[model samples]
Target: MGTSASKLAILDIVLNGLMRRYKERVPDVGIILDAMVSDGIVKSTSDIENDHIAFRTMGVPQLGVKSFEKIFLHFGYEKRDHYFFEGKKLDAWWYSPPRATDPRIFVSELRVGDLSEESQHIIHSYTNEVTVDGIATDPVDYLDLDNGEAVDAFLHQPLWRTPTTADYQSLLQESEYAAWVIYNRYYLNHFTISVHNLPEGYNTVASFNDFLEKHGIKLNTSGGKIKVSPDGGLLQSSTVAEMLDAEFANGEKLRISGSYVEFAERKVLPEFASLPAGEIKRKHRRDGFEAGNADKIFESTYTTQTGR
Candidate 1:
């Protein structure tokens, strides 16, 4: 799929905004880039191809995949496969880029109603604040998607009131994903690194992981250091979430999960094995995601991984 140059320009601005803030919030982004440059992985950060970027949402009528997807769709992204994480009480989807050079998008939403009544109440008490005239609101409905500045601001802006420490803790006990969305509304969750493109010695998750550990970067060990797809076509790993000194309501302070970096290695498809290395392209590689891999990847932000 393709869009007009004007729209593409706006998309660039919006994506740049998301990544800029993401890198700032997650220090590992810069740490990894700087180390990569020093180690001759590439000349600079620009040489690393972004595999994908992800976001989390509250699965309510006001905002979720149905509402948040309009922004990218307007910019020419085509919605592809849908993934459901029953254990996490979430639903997710992946969107293909308008151009091969752009990163894919992975967005997931919390199934609020599935939570315990108390947990649901705590989430609604805050999420319910995002309203105008007592009716649920879809924040993106008012955005001029073509206006890059406004959209960029919206991505970083808070949609609800600050969550109280008690409410946040209660939700966290039941669903870490819920607690995350409650505080970090619409913040880019994680941006991925396509390790397969790096110089030969650092071209796989295993090798890149060793490089990261040597530089003091922490890896999420929820499922294992590496979460591989059943077919062995996709392998992944991520940094344990960076903890932030969060300030909740009433001056309550606690260290909370922020964001993290993910590394992905998508092996070339079997059918494309005969293709010449110079001739192979993104299409010849494993496409889309594997739910089994993503399920563990989600824990990158969970306390289980972050606390490690």
Candidate 2:
């Protein structure tokens, strides 16, 4: 397949795999995604250019960002700048795509050691379960990666046993990040729509937020409705995660917040756009993500935000 074809094929596999598993827990993905198309948000799923997709993982010895990033690296993505969140205990890195049109990848790992001892033990117990089961595998196999099966397997694989209600409560009290990864292992946290590519009236995050709210979608308002970078190069907003039923190890089913979608609009740098078209050597749009922006976006799935 050609570059565009190959990108779409991989995305199809990832999105389908994610939605399948995500819908098992939360049904809003299909509802919102389908509505976006049916309501003319974009021509179709294929026409929606993604700015990035994010994954959340535990920062344990065996499993974390390192293991998860291999899948993208095999597909020819290169690691880019790193971001740190002191309050959230997260360390993330965004990867540059092999092809410019391909959506960028963002993966963040919770610093397990930084949490309270009880929270750390609860998280480690689950990561240990995944490690013992040998669910972790190399994502660099050419045949499997090219065919998109490997990526699907990686995303859908269960890396941890269910957490007990008591343990989950303990983790949640200390760090909502820990609670999230323990229950939802290796699932797509959120996928972003490139707002800059949207049609004239909807090309900005503000307008897109207006459109989403009109459809009854609630957005994260922790920092603000829209999180803008200090330099005003990146603006972002996200829907509050939908709450869904989750069965714990103790045989208790309870409602919990699940994944949500995000929107981003990257502004063109004045210096870059002012250059003659042929003379511009670098990408015109702001390239990296803002740590402050992402920190608030991560809270979209928190119980306090989702109110599950």
Which candidate number maximizes lDDT? Answer: 1
Candidate 2 lDDT over residue span 221-304, tens digit each: 989999999999899999899787788986898787778889999887887777764453326889889999999999999977
lDDT of 2: 0.80
TM-score of each: 0.98, 0.87
Which pairs of residues collide in candidate 1? none
Worst 10 residues of 1 by lDDT: 123-132
User: For each candidate, how many residue pairs have backbone atoms clashing (under 3 Å)?
Assistant: 0, 0
Query: Per-residue lDDT for 66-146 in model 1, tens only?
Result: 999999999999999999899999999999999899999999999988999999888878778878788888878889998
Number of the top candidate by TM-score? Answer: 1
Question: lDDT of all predictions, in order shown?
Answer: 0.92, 0.80
Off by over 4 Å in 2: 1-16, 19-26, 132-147, 274-282
Candidate 1 scores a C-alpha RMSD against the true structure in Å of: 0.9
C-alpha RMSD of candidate 2: 3.8
